[model samples]
Structures are given as structure tokens and as C-alpha cells.
Target: MDEQALIPDSQQGDLNAFNRLVLAYQDLAFNIAYRMLGDEARAEECTQEAFFSAYRHLGSYRGGSFKAWVLRMVTNACYDELRRRKRRPVIPLEPLNDTDEEIESPAWLASSDPSPEEVVHLKELDTAIDHCLSTLLPDFRSVVILVDVQNMEYEEVSSILKSPLGTIKSRLARARQKMRDCLQGFEELLPSEYRHEQEGK
Candidate 1:
């Protein structure tokens, strides 16, 4: 059955259809949680909690984009997790191992002859991006994550964020500009080609 038909049926307590929906969106939901929380364990917990919360509130979902609805739920769960963490402080950074420095480029940017120095530089850039993302207010970060990292269009981000399209565009533009500024500090560490290209732009 199509996703639209399955949603209402699932809302009415069809475990099979709900499970199918879970299968379709679990990775997307978990990745969002992981990105937001920046902790694998906490992200997993948030993902599980979000799915359960969604199941409990399934009846409240009144048609239209089920993916967007579930994503909203996931985002809410991540927000709640952040709030809870604020109430009870914990050590901030995760411990890293040497192997973690290995670079695996995104498919869109992958190249065959990347060097070890290049790998480390790209990894540092990734870390800088994560740091800059963490600095953003949650609302702004959510828009960036949804539109940039998750590759959602402006309209989908508007629907997911429940905001005006103009707001979404403005927030995304500001977020990207902020990230670019944050990355500028690391220009010396970047590949010379990248540095020259960025300087030209």
C-alpha cells in the first residue's frame, strides 16, 4: 500500500503499517537526533523516545506529509533532550581515538587520490563545522540541519519548521554565512587549492 493509505491505517493501530513507516524513516530520524544531540548514545535514546511518542500521538496526526510530521516529532524529542541536559550538567566532549581521524569523504566530494594530510585537514574542517553548528541557536540550527545537512527544500523546511518560507530562507542564509566565517579561521590548514578557490570567491 502507498504511504498515505498506510498512515491512517497505522493511526488506527495497525502495527504492520506503523512498522513499515518505522522502517522507512528510522535512519532519517536517528541521524537528525545524532546531529542535534552530538552524542551517539543520547541520540539513540532520543530516537527511540521520539518513535514511541509518535506512536502514542499518531491519532493527532491529521494527514498531509507524514515524513514531515515524524521529523517534527524527532526534532521535538531532541529539543527536550537538550533541555533536560541543561537542567543536569555533564561532561561535554566525547573521547576520541586515533582511528577516528580517518577521513571518509561524502560521496559528492570523494576523490581517488586524497592524501593522509588532506584527510586530516578535511577531518578538521568537519570538526570546525560541527563546532560552528553547535554555536547556533537551536531554531537556527534546526533550519540549517534540515535544509543543508538533510537536503530538504525550502518548502519542506517551512512545513517541518512550521515557519514562513521567508524565515526559512533568511535563517538558512544566515547560518551558511556564519559557517563560512567560522571556516575562514582554518584557511591556513586547508588544501592550497581549496584556500585559493575560497579566496577567489
Candidate 2:
């Protein structure tokens, strides 16, 4: 069924219907969390919490752009998590790059029949992008993730972030500039097309 059909059922306390929405959105939600927090476990936790919060608040949903509404929830959850972590920071024994072996092999990045060389290049590009994203402030990072990575429009991101459109545009501009500077350092690892795109920035 279409997502619109699922929403009413989910709003009526149908667990299965809500779960279908979860299945549809969890990957994108988790990716947003992961990109925001840079921790898989925390990302998973935030995604689950966002879903729970959504189910509870479903009645309050005023229609229009359910996906964007869900994203707003997940974004709030991530922000909350970030705030908590700020209060009690813990150092991980493993470095980010060391722990990202699995991230380097995401199924979404795979072609139906990717060559060994292509796979390696994809991994490198993913790592490079991740590193660049990590250097950004959380607010700037979130803007770029929503706009550039998640392919959201400026208005949608502004709505999700509850910020003004001009604020969103400014954050996106600064974030993109940061990423361009960061990516320039990793130009050799980027695919030719991506390298050209970066260079053109």
C-alpha cells in the first residue's frame, strides 16, 4: 500500500502498520543518525527512539510530508543524544577508521557486478566523505546531510530543522565550503567524476 494508506492505520494504533512505516524509513533514519552522531550503535538507538516517539505522537501529525515529519523526529532524537554525550563524553578504544570496515562495504554502494577496483574506490570515497563530514559542526553537518546527502530541498530542511530559510541556506553554504576544503585533501582517493565535482566547487 502507499505510505498515505499506512499512516492512518498506524495512527489508529495498528502495530503492523506502524512497523511497515518503520521498515520503509528505518534505513534513511539510521543513516541520518549515523551521519549525525558517527556511531552505529547510537544511530540505531536514536532511530528506534524516533519511531517510538512518532507512534506516540502520530495523532498530533498535521498531515503533509510524513517522511519530513519523521525526519524531524529523528533529527530531534539525534540532537538530544548529542546533548547527553556532551555531558558525559567517553573515548572509544578503537579509532573511527578502524571501526568503519563494515561501513566501507555498504550494499547500497555496490553495483550489481562491481569490479574489485571499483569496490576499492567506492570504499575510499565513502571513507573520505565520512571524514569530511566529521569535521563539521553538528548544525552545519546536519544541514549538509539533509540537503546534499539526503537530497532534501532548502525549505524542507528549514522546516525539519525549525530554522529560517536564510539560516538553512547559510548553514548549507558554510557546510559545503568545509566539505570542499576537506575533500580537496582526499582528491586522490575520490572517483574521477567525484574528484572533478570537488575541483569544480
TM-score of each: 0.78, 0.79
lDDT of each: 0.80, 0.84
lDDT of 2 by residue, 47-117 (tens): 99999899989999989888889999999999999889989887434322445643444443323333444
In model 2, which residue pairs have backbone atoms overlapping below 3 Å? Answer: none
Candidate 2 residue spans exceeding 4 A from truth: 94-123, 193-201
Q: Candidate 2, after superposition: displacement of residue 93 in Å?
A: 2.5
lDDT of 1 by residue, 98-143 (tens): 6775334343233333334434555665555565676677788889
Top candidate (lDDT): 2
